[model samples]
Target: MHLRKLIPFIGLVGLCCACVFAQQPAATGLVDAARGRVAIPDPTKPPPLTNSVNDDQRRPRNYDMQPPTIPHRVDGYQIDKNFNKCMDCHARDKSAFTLAVPVSPTHYIDRDGKALQQISTRRYFCLQCHFAQEPVQPIVGNGFENVDALAKKAADASQAGKK
Candidate 1:
């Protein structure tokens, strides 16, 4: 009976020790030794910048380039069992001759090479993979230039970089 009563106290002390050990400073001077403390630097290094891409950045090339970014705002768009905004334009049946941009041919193929005429229930939500965005103004400054025309320029750049 007495041992059972003491079990909670022992557990509490062990937990307190664990907390203290976790707070103790490391040998690396990056951490402060006293007050069981460490210091952290403010305003960490900025993320590396990628060159801005326009529609022209999409091109036919030997190797795959990065996927093009979504070009419009996607916030508050429904992308679930209840609704999907993307199909109004890109559905295989609707896009052709309907003033809708046709979906990529890749979208039609299933893993088994069968043409999945209907959007898979798993992929019913278009926003899961696609998003909309607008060009952001330069936050600070950069000298980067857009290739502006992907179909012709990508091959040259890739070839030049290789050589």
Candidate 2:
């Protein structure tokens, strides 16, 4: 009697194990296509660095709130905790001598709204907002238009209505 009950339980466990180990067909299409390509490049060799030409042309800001882009290359400009190379020319006192635009007055304001003699810790890293403007082909397409363009279109429509 004991063996008869034990045999059925053993058979059920064996059936479950067989189901778990049963081979399923490999996933097709996209999965197989992605698997054919190399996921990671060789780590031993460094990737080629592309040098972008510095145009030095000031691009008009799309909006008033946008930060001005850097007009020149900032290659090898040290901006560690101890120093910032941008301040050499853009500092309030240094701007007059170097002919570089002085950093904004807002850069001196602290988080608590207190003004400091030096650049605030919150705004010390210039690269956080300012990036070197480089002319390059867009990696993806966009249909973005600025507010000024929309306003001009509205104005033109209103003028046409009067005429």
Candidate 3:
């Protein structure tokens, strides 16, 4: 009947009205902290790109099992499926002539615990595990203590307690 059609139309309008009234206005000063005072609607200017560290001097690892960081800048280096520019200098045979540290022997091992003659497919991507540094202040402060420093502190505290 016409009444059944009118009932659905009335229910749709009620639902529309409920949805419109249910929305609360965004709270004042509820800005995103990550955007750093940038308004939600306004576009933010990106910071200038900083140069990567290119000194080539190796930095000490912060903890055990930490991957060594890239010492030189790798801008524009091709790292596609067809080519890996890093292998030119860092491959086992090439390292001797290039004076670049060779990729670790572990890189040649497969995920199944078997050794391969070349770098394993799983470990071929260098950037996934290592990063180059830039001379820029971190956005947030780091208070990370290395494993050695924490161990030394624990040793010192135990020595004092035994006294």
Candidate 4:
């Protein structure tokens, strides 16, 4: 008797499920459009390969702790285990003659804080920290404000509040 009642209940559930599934629309809008299209590259024309031009004009640092960007082109400048062309111009003794800013005195200190007569190997690679500035559009939008700008805004607000 119980089994006969359970059979009708199960049948009702299956019918409801079938109705729900039947009412669902076909996945045919964006998916169907994408499936019908073939993304083919232009075989006759090649994509342009352009090199970024370095900005020789010195740009001011946004913050005090920021590393200065290279103000000149550094392409083909050798910086390897055997040779560091940067030292030829930026070394302490050579800076006066070359008119290039010398590497920071801190670069002469080792990891243990021992001062060496020569630039510590830890800081030998100039390009590792200093990169040439290139004029290029930012890939993404940013509303970032510098520390000085933020500070000035706060100060201005405080002064207005006092008045």
Cα RMSD to native, each candidate? Answer: 12.3, 11.1, 8.4, 11.8
Q: Would you estimate the TM-scores of all the predictions?
A: 0.41, 0.68, 0.74, 0.66
Candidate 2 Cα misplacement greater than 4 A, ranges: 1-49
Ten contiguous residues minimizing lDDT sum, candidate 3: 24-33
What is the overall TM-score of model 2 with all chains considered together? 0.68
lDDT of 1 by residue, 1-163 (tens): 6999999999999999877775554633334322224244443454554443435343333334434455544455666666666776668788875655566666666777777877765456565564444455545555644555564588889899999
Model 2 residue 59 lDDT? 70
What is candidate 3's TM-score against the reference? 0.74
Question: Whole-model Cα lDDT per candidate?
Answer: 0.58, 0.78, 0.85, 0.77
RMSD of 2: 11.1
Model 3, span 38-134: residue lDDT tens: 6557888868879999998999999878999988999888988899998988999998899999998899999998999988998898899988898
Poorest lDDT segment (10 consecutive residues) of candidate 1: 29-38
* lDDT score, candidate 3, position 104: 86
Off by over 4 Å in 1: 1-66, 96-98, 121-123, 137-163
lDDT rank order: 3, 2, 4, 1
